[model samples]
Target: MKKKLGFLALLLVITMLVVSACGSKDEGKSKDSKNASGDEQIELEFWTMQLQPTFTDYINGIIKDFEGENPNIKIKWLDVPAADLSKKILSAVTTNTAPDVVNLNPTFASQLAELDALVNMDEAVSDEDKALYVKGAWEANNINGTTFAIPWYLSTSVTLNNKAIFEEAGLDPEKPATTYEEAAEYAKIIKEKTGKYGYFPSMDLSLVLQHMVMMGADLTNEDGTKAAFNSPEGLYAFEYFTKLYQDGLIPREALTGDQRSTIDMYQAGQVAFFDGSQFIVQVKENAPDLYANTIPSQAITGKSGKKTMSVQNVVVPKQTKHQEAAVKFALFLTNGKNQLEFSKLTPILPSNVEALADPYFTEAGDDAEPTDLVRIVSASQLDSAELLVPPMKNYDELRQAMYDAISASMLGEMTPQEALDQAEQEWNDILAK
Candidate 1:
């Protein structure tokens, strides 16, 4: 009787162990069932700079549409103010909590690319996909031969001249200045005839760099290791601005003031021309009288017949868990259809080639408004406008050095040669680091 009872106890213990093992196996299988079925859900975090308050509806609608099409993928969106975007991104990267994808201008993106903190979009994007964007926009995100971001929106400066001011200055509003030299000549005439400042070049906007590039100043030497803007080309560029300042062609305050000062002067009918993005809307809304007399013209071309373009792009971080999904979402966000939709909400131009072909951008009838004309003109110049400052690791430092030299030269504190030499040496030292 004792042996039989022991056998029964052993059987019960074995049975309990078998049941527990089977239950554990079943739970493990259940957990992986979604993966086995290729239906696992993926979550992605996306960040945008200063786009929420104005683009809330558009962004939410996009999110809804994207999720509907890609049921297995979900996007968590965050809108950050433009000023805080860089700081937030840096902090997130340091803490390994970076978003999967984020919006950044090429200038800012270059900084991260240098640190190898972003994915190489060139390898992720196919040749066919690359052809879909504007050539300049597509190339602008390339850092050290590898593209790191997808171009989203683009803005090339166009000349917005006050027709009344032009006429008052004895200049033809219809035949606006097409080059910087011509613009200087026009400025002189306008100031002489109308007793109003012809134009106020926004020096604080770093336009002096654009002017240098337009004058054929090589920004960096071979391999981009040292500064090359101190060459003869750079001297010519600096002297150009110095002459403008010395002759009083541009506003005296421009040496220290921002683009807003010039915009205000333009609105108050104190200036003849204002080169900027599609600002006709602001003029139309703030000063209707000035808008009525505004005429839109093509961007002022340099000797190379190229203008400068400002580009914003979408980029995926290297820390993303879902790279393929993040890239897919980025492509979707920048596709021609979506980009066209976004362009409708703002005056900015689209980077998508197909979007650029839309009638909304191509057509500017005789009866078109000044804003419409500006858009048309701005779009037409994208093919010829290049990013003057390409993606460089030390771009911010280099730009500041160049700007400091320009300011010193304009203020008569330093000769153009001395300023260029100092800037070139400083840039080389930065590169050496």
Candidate 2:
């Protein structure tokens, strides 16, 4: 009887052990299922202009660091060619595959901002964050009081001189023309002395026109109801380009050449003085010896003596799912340290004033003086810069037409006034449509 009781207890112990093992397996299964409720990793898409080989490492390194810190989020970069940006972005948006963030021209930002395709960053950005950019920059991204983008980088038309050309013409190589008249006189001298094109009126008329508009033309008036381009101010700009071309200060090629070709001419030293982007730092880096003479440009004096600058902005697309992350990234990219890094790699100015004080400029080498030139250009953004025309709905088409008309006039197919008058009618009609 004792032996039988002992056997029963042993059987009970074995059964209990089997039950405990089963319970442990169930808990393991439960924990494995809980992964469904774990934090969902998010992915974001960002787009930027084409970068040269020199800047590839800097950009990729920044992105890699950001990803390391935020492993929960993944970033996919879409680099679009600067020339095909509009078409590519628009196609992507139209097809419902747009990037979460886009680095775009302020002109296009205004147009997209107008279409309600960008998120209003006003509520997302704090007053302190808002203070990061120069006064009118954020305002430039706002259309009708709605902020759609944040200023990313600043660019303005600045004069670049070939020191050799200046010396040959008996002009001061160190002191570039402070006024348009002075620039024109130097241009005249350059043409006569060297037989090279003295200057290239910006191939893009919008740049020159915007400066004229800011100087007081007001293409669209204060009321925003009337067109002002037919006024004396408008005609003044028309005459400026006409005079430059007709006076032989600029070559006939410039009348139809775009910014790329114009810059190419300047880099080749074929043009003595050229209006180019403020971002000469990257240019200097690319061709160290050639860019030795580049400097921060000031506004060419219009008959009115006013100066103006232009800015490019970063925008958050309306269709993005990662709005907060995109905003954070945009701010990070444009903040003091990063903006300075970008400015060093590219010729674009940092939108942040604090960045202007950074050692990148202070510790720059002789070969890197253009970095300081960029810093000076960045500092002038607040005092001298103004918004380009608010993006218009049919902007690309309208701009092409305007350029065509102006080019036709330059080719002697029409007069400047006639081209502008037709442009006014065409633009107003497009707006009405």
Candidate 3:
């Protein structure tokens, strides 16, 4: 009886061991199955700068449509304030939590490219895909021959004139200035006749820089180590602006004022012309009476026939885990059809070449509003619009130095040559370190 009990206990022990092994194997298989299934799904995070409140519906619809077309991929969207984008992106990058894709202006995009934080789209984008965008817009994101981002929306400054003011000044409202010199001449006449300021150049922005580039001043040396704006072309640019200030063609406040001040002047009928993108909408909304007298004209061109183009672009980060999916979504977002749809909702112009060819952009109805005319005129200049400021790591500092020198020259603290030379020296010192 004792031997029989011992055998039964041994059998029970062996049986328990077999059962436990089987359970462990099954659990391992289950875990493997779950992982394999999870691997099939791809999630992407996307960020845009200050596009949320106004474009939430449109963007959400696009996301839904994209998910439907690509069932395996999911996108997580985040809208960041324009002012906080750079800081937010920097923090995300530092933590290795950067979004798969993000929207940024060319300036900020270039800064990241300099840091090697952005993917080189030139290597990833096909030639056929590259040809879809405007040449200038496409090139705007290219730094050191590597394209780091894809162009999305674009704008070029156009001359907006107060027709009533022009007429009162005895200038032909129908024939607006097409060149900077012509603009200056018109400014003199307007101020002389109507006793109102003619126009205020945007000193805070890149207007003066664009003018210099238009006059053939190279922004930097071949290696981008030092300032090249101190050349003869640079001197011409300085002298031109100095002459405008001395002659009182531009408002004195322009040397220090922001775009808001200029817009105020235009709205109050204190100025005849205001050079900007499709800002007529604001004028229409803020002062309907001023809108009635506003006329849109082609942007003032330099001898090069190139207008200053500013581009907003979408980029994929190098740290993204889902590069293929992220790039595909980016291309989808900026495709001709989608870009055209976005343009219809806002006054922005599309960077896609095919979108520009769309009838919506090409045609203006007989009863088109002043804003419509502005859009038409602005769109017409896209072909000739080139980015005046190329992507450089120290661009902001360089621009500030140039602005300071220009300000000094305008204030009579330094001659044009002296101001430019000092600015050039400062720029070289900044780049050296």
Candidate 2 Cα misplacement greater than 4 A, ranges? 1-40, 52-56, 67-71, 83-85, 223-225, 277-290, 293-299, 303-310, 359-371, 374-378, 413-415
Ten consecutive residues with minimal summed lDDT in candidate 2? 26-35
lDDT of candidates 1 onward, in order: 0.82, 0.67, 0.82
TM-scores, all candidates, are 0.90, 0.79, 0.90
For model 1, the run of ten residues with the poorest summed lDDT: 24-33
Clash totals for all models, in order? Answer: 0, 2, 0
For candidate 2, write residues 195-312 as lDDT tens digits: 8877776756465455456445666555454456777777666666777887778877676656777767877778877666553654675657767766555646555544455667
Model 3 residue 100 CA deviation in Å? 0.5
Clashing residue pairs in candidate 2, if any? 180-301, 279-347
Error of 2 at 71 (Å): 4.6
Tell me how far the alpha carbon of residue 204 in candidate 2 is from the true structure, in angstroms, after superposition.
2.6
lDDT by residue for model 3 over 308-425, one digit each (tens)? 8889999998767667888999999999989999998888899999999998877889888888887788898887888888887656667778899988898889999999999989
Candidate 3 deviant stretches above 4 angstroms? 1-39
lDDT (C-alpha) at residue 371 in model 1: 88
* Candidate 2 CA-lDDT value: 0.67
